[model samples]
Target: MPVLVKDYTWSETDTEVLITVPLKGVKPSKADIFSSEDYVKINYTPYLFEVFLYAPVVEEESSIRVGNGVVEMRLCKKEKVIWGQLESNIKMDKEEMRRKREDVVKAVQEKMEQEQMERATKKREAEKLAIKQQMQLEEEAHSKIEKEKQDERDKAMEELEEWKQHKQEETKTTSITNKPTIQPAQLKQQQNSKLSHNMWQDNKDIPDSQRPAPRSGGKITVNFTPRYFPTAARESTEKEEQEWLAKMAAARKIQAGTPSEINKNNPMLLKDKACGFFKAGDYEAAINAFSQAISLNPMLPVLYSNRAACYLKLNDNEKCIQDATRALELLYPVVPSNHIQRAKVFVRRGTAYANIGNHGLALQDYEAAEKLDPDNTQLQTDIVQIRNLISCDS
Candidate 1:
């Protein structure tokens, strides 16, 4: 009799093979599973599933469980060897089985191709949308800056008008208070002199090339020195001299020491300097700066994490692990431990561990990072690669 099969899924680990077959409305007690060193068979009244193993398995170690309308079998391999494919030969009509296999392979290939094309199309659409949004944001930012410039110009013009009005008011008050009883000719002469002085003062700011040329007849030169002194200096006495001496002493004190000193205890300043060194790719300088920042502010986990990154760049795996661990310890009290910063620290530590050939610790850290950033495809890939490495090593 020919063996029948049902809808199923199968997977393998380094030492075991697992198969899940849907039993659909069948009771667990109604299922029967049989196993040998090279084959597994399952029957549940209206359904059956069977597979011939490509390699030998421990029949005594094989086990089956039925739950939630499904039967799962776990077969332990006798030898720890990687299987290229799962199934062996089946006792079916040779030509019919060949045609069935070809049809299945073609269907699977077409489905995979369709899925790849769909993914490509979605990726292109996402990229186009992101570009469009970025362009819109840039245009809005430019428009905002232009509007701010226009507002500044308007404010300057308003201030100028206000100043002119204040000056005019001052001039009117002076004319009303000093209304002298003079003849029209004298008044006209005074007005002419004032107008000429105003014109000269205004033209003084203009460049010599842009100003109007003087008449060719003669040149005028005038020089005057005022006999005036500041009130503070003019009234200097014993008390003033004492105050001046005290001020000079204070100035000397500042010049002699304080001005040349730097406040190394400022954590924020140290952090800023560290970030600058990091951007410049000076890993050693960045590490020193971050170390100072951490000393000044030991509670800041980011400083430790940043120092760990610098150590990573310097290939100091031990220091990297130490700093990363310190950062995690500091971050433990934070409410949200799964932040991106924490995730980055985990990744850094995982990389350091992996570099030292400690795949077990690296896998643990990678798994933790994956929980923090589940959508990070690179982290997922790292996890898979680490698992494969562990399996190969085992």
Candidate 2:
């Protein structure tokens, strides 16, 4: 059951009443508030606050401000007279409260639906605009390609005309008798070049200058960006955003000092830091902290024992067993002062063994812990459980 909030403060003027509800550890964005002419409510998960107004107020004019671990509300009173109380003294039973809750919930859900519709409409408009721009860009690219082809054809025609004129002039100036004796390899190269020129020139139906050009040989590889979206690279923040996220992940990683600097700080402090991390449910960070503590002082049995608990939480059964055994070894010659810790070490090791399907070894370790702490009911329970497991296996 949620505890009722009765300790809230209120002040009233002739035409306004201000109420402040202290809600510790509550964020403003997460708190849900509903206000009507005669009702005011604030729901912050486990905590719920509601009040029936002593006098009717203008709900639309009223305002609520949440900040600094408190929710402040100002109600605009309809009447000019000062009210005796901020809320009605009459207490509401469960049925009345339930109806009020349902009413406010319906209103909130309706408001949320309207907001979702607005967002969807905006998204559709944006998508349509993007599609139109992309289509326009594709059309422009098609026209540009056609223009480039025309320009290349004109350039080829000019080059072919210049070549024909040069060949005619060379023929008129030279004679076969004046030609030098050519090597067989050179004569064959000239014959191949003449055959290639004639092949394009042999198209008599089309004008010589207008003949189709043969493309140069060799592969031309073109690479395009691998993207799921059609957005241009210059318009996207994907690369920068990814780099920022990578940096944030790196910053959150656990970092331990080098072995040479492990002894610089107090072992107790390092152990405390490890315990804090373990309590916060960061098992990986706790393990790193525990290792640093162990490197500073390996003789401390408690350090190894605590690190074992972290390993157990992470489900590293073999490492848990190793740490627990190391702790037990360091806690030699069981005495009155260390009996509790010794039993704890035995329990941890036994639990690790039980996890790894070694019921026989688990039973042995539990029995040892029972001898150290005879009154430990939990330890006795574990002993019984191991015995039952061993019996079932046999």
Candidate 3:
């Protein structure tokens, strides 16, 4: 059942109607607005609002705006007349209203998908046209240079024929000082023309710095911050866990840990099996076991944190970062109860980030963990190392 929203305001002009609905604690992205020429609806979780308009509106020209915790619709009236009421008195039963909303929603969704496809098609066509123009420009530049060379070749051939004729005529004369010969200055001018033509073509191809750069994208990395346990989260248990984790920071300690008490409903047995593989140095098997445990109990943050240790041992920093980050997210809200676990995950993820040359992000995680376990000298050292790495990069 939806809570019908009664708090809405509306005003009308001769040609348009402006309707505004204020939704407390609701963002525009979270609100789903559906509309047709005769109907409008707003669905934001428990809050729901819908209306069957008294008169028809031009749905194509109607516009919606959302800002500052309110959704406003400027509906273009089909007839230039003010309506007595916003909604029609004709009431709809639950099933009828459901059918109407469903039909309208389907139509709206189909239109959105069609528009997206059209936009994508247009984008691809534009890219093809742009590349084609670049190719034509380059080809024209090459053709011009070739034509310049051919004209120079014809001029040189004519000059050679004239020289041959002159030499033939001068064969019978001892004094040949007045013969028409190609001058050095003429040769230099021809050379300059060819050089300038070639240079122009060379300049037609833009330098790398002047041209637009290729589009690029960066990797998305998630980092979670642990809560600062000022009063010692979980007291003695938290202290002991933090100390143990600090000792095993390098992940070299392989322990034959005790198994959890067996219960038919308990999933710890699966986790214990993964830990056993981890202890025996069968990291791949441990990872598979951990994955199985995660599939069974994905809400357990410990499973991801444990699997992250195995990934780190295998020198797979990327996987380590992913698992560690997931573990921290599972331990969200950063309360005192989860402070210890969250800190451990933060340290593990920080180490993974450091391994992958993301010292700045690693430092961020380390600093968050430090607030939770201020007495841990190892955490302080890790933080210092990350800071040093960051400074070196700068």
Candidate 4:
């Protein structure tokens, strides 16, 4: 229904008998009023005035109506109006039609532009989500590949370890079959040089002056010879067996007390544990464990000697000498029965004494160890060096 009509201007330089239609709560659409040809038709005719209208202002409580020489009009969802009769044939008012068309056109163009912006925003969001999913998938694949590689490495290491154990067993069996049971001292002396000093092998053939100086002092000199034991005679066999058993015991002690496994079952376990710690290159741990072990079992000379070794490794000569002196006090009297053990403690203590510049005490320990174990290569070597030092000092 027609509501009100008012005069309006489409442009500053253009005028017409104008009409505006108010939609109230309803917005007017271009599809309801105009066609595709209307825009082309409007652009070609400048005689018709242009018009601008807004989207329906539904929230406004009141409406407006005004009339000048130009006519302003209002229309609702339910209304249509007729303009005053055209001046020519029964025809449309070009100005009135243009005004109506332009209003609808502007609204449609704005709506299309808004829809395009929303579409572009949705597309960008989708692209970002796709990139995030792809990255997550790649990370999962990489993690799986890494797990597989690590599994392969672990399997290879296990197989290699098993093969090594098999070879070691075969070597042990072959060596046992080829060699008869030998005297422990004879076997030990031969093996000790290889285990205790690899450097000696390289320089063993070299003359005295050509060899490096002994770390304790004086010159380095060594002598080696193979000795035969009587395996046929019963007394000789018993002596050989006893000597062999002692050598085996010593070997077991050395192996068991290595840094990898300290014999906790033994009273000397704590000391051995400390020695192990020192071999593992953790001097502080070795020292503390050794001290604790000594506290736990003070009567054992081995514990004191072992702790002394740790102190020596740490370059704490005073503590080393103290431990060695303690070991000597406990061990010296029993040398007739336990010469090898006493000799080892003496040599170690003497080394500590030498480090502190007490040549006399160092010499004394060296001499004592030598007297107890006259055939011990290590003790003999040490005695020769002490004698050389005495000669040099004199």
Candidate with the greatest lDDT versus the true structure: 2
- Extract clashing residue pairs from model 1: none
The segments of candidate 2 whose C-alpha lies over 4 angstroms from its true place after superposition are 11-18, 24-39, 44-47, 52-69, 73-101, 165-394
Q: Sort by lDDT, best first: what order?
A: 2, 3, 1, 4
**Which run of 10 residues does model 2 get worst, by summed lDDT?**
217-226
What's model 3's lDDT at 93?
69
Regions more than 4 Å wrong, model 3 = 175-394
TM per candidate comes to 0.34, 0.39, 0.44, 0.32
In Å, residue 7's CA in model 4 sits off its true spot by 99
**Mind sharing the TM-score for model 2?**
0.39
lDDT of 2 by residue, 1-394 (tens): 7666788999999989999998868666456666777778776766878898888898778899999999999989998998887766444566776776567545644554455456656876998998898778777767676776677677666777776677668768989588556678766666565556664556465433333334354332333334433446677656644554454345334335565654235565566656655644456877897897777667777889999998887669899999999888766544445678988888888888988999988888889989988988977887787888889999
Better of 1 and 2 by TM-score: 2
Model 3 residue 45 CA deviation in Å: 3.1
Candidate 3 residue-wise lDDT, 110-203, digit = tens: 5654554566568769989987987787777677767767776676556545654665575667455764565787666655554433422344
lDDT agreement of model 3 with the native: 0.71
Candidate 4 lDDT over 182-285, as tens digits, reads 57765655565355435455545432222222222223233222223434454354554566455435533542234454334334545545554554445687
**Against the unseen true structure, what C-alpha lDDT does each candidate score?**
0.69, 0.72, 0.71, 0.53
Which candidate number has the best TM-score? 3
Model 1: per-residue Cα lDDT over 1-394, one tens digit each: 5336646888898799988888778767556665566766676666777666778888578887889888888989998987867886554567855664455434534454455456656876998998798778777767776776677666655654565577568667777667556677666665565454344445354322222222124222332232122335455354544444454344333311132332265554566566656644457887998887676567667788999988887779999999999888766532332267778999999989988999999999999888888899989998999999999999
